[model samples]
Target: MTKITYVEPDGSRIEVEAENGSTVMENAIMNGVPGIVAECGGACTCATCHVYVDDAWTETVGGPSVMEEDMLDFAFDVRENSRLSCQIKVRDELDGLVVNVPTRQG
Candidate 1:
């Protein structure tokens, strides 16, 4: 299990032991973390699950794929570090990953 720390826009944190192979968005939605709507489930269609990965962990987590990149374009606060959490599969190598939930999802 990887420890994924999800930070909200207001600086609140919700840390969880995410299962391997499950996406960050899946964990967040299942754990009932607000701010991540995940309307399209784990499909890279809706950007409601948008998150900003901490720069320190970007390379470790890697960048999003073409489809995820396309969906992120529609996110509320699109940034260079913006990623659709659903596209990030959890792994032992990604332990302690930190992602910030966007202020809004639309």
Candidate 2:
């Protein structure tokens, strides 16, 4: 399991044990972590699970693909580091991944 930390809009942090091959959004939903609506249920069709990856982890988390970028247009406060959590698969290399949840759903 990888360790993924999600910071809420209020600055509260939630650390979850993420299963390898699963998605960051799934881990958050499983843990009942707030701030991620995940209306599309990991389908990558919605921006409800948007998050800002920590600057330090940007290279590792990677940039959004064309499809993801298109969907992000519907997200609130989209940033250079913003990503759809469903697109972020958990991996051993991402053990300490940290992301900040936005204040509201997109």
**Which candidate achieves the best TM-score against the true structure?**
2
Off by over 4 Å in 1: none
Task: List residue ranges in candidate 2 displaced over 4 A.
Answer: none
Worst 10 residues of 1 by lDDT: 68-77
Q: List, residue by residue over 76-101, the lDDT tens digit for candidate 2.
A: 99999999999999998899999999
lDDT for position 41 in model 1 = 80
lDDT of each: 0.91, 0.94
Residue 68 displacement (Å), model 2: 0.3
Judging by lDDT against the true structure, name the best candidate: 2
Superposed Cα deviation of residue 42, candidate 1 (Å): 1.0
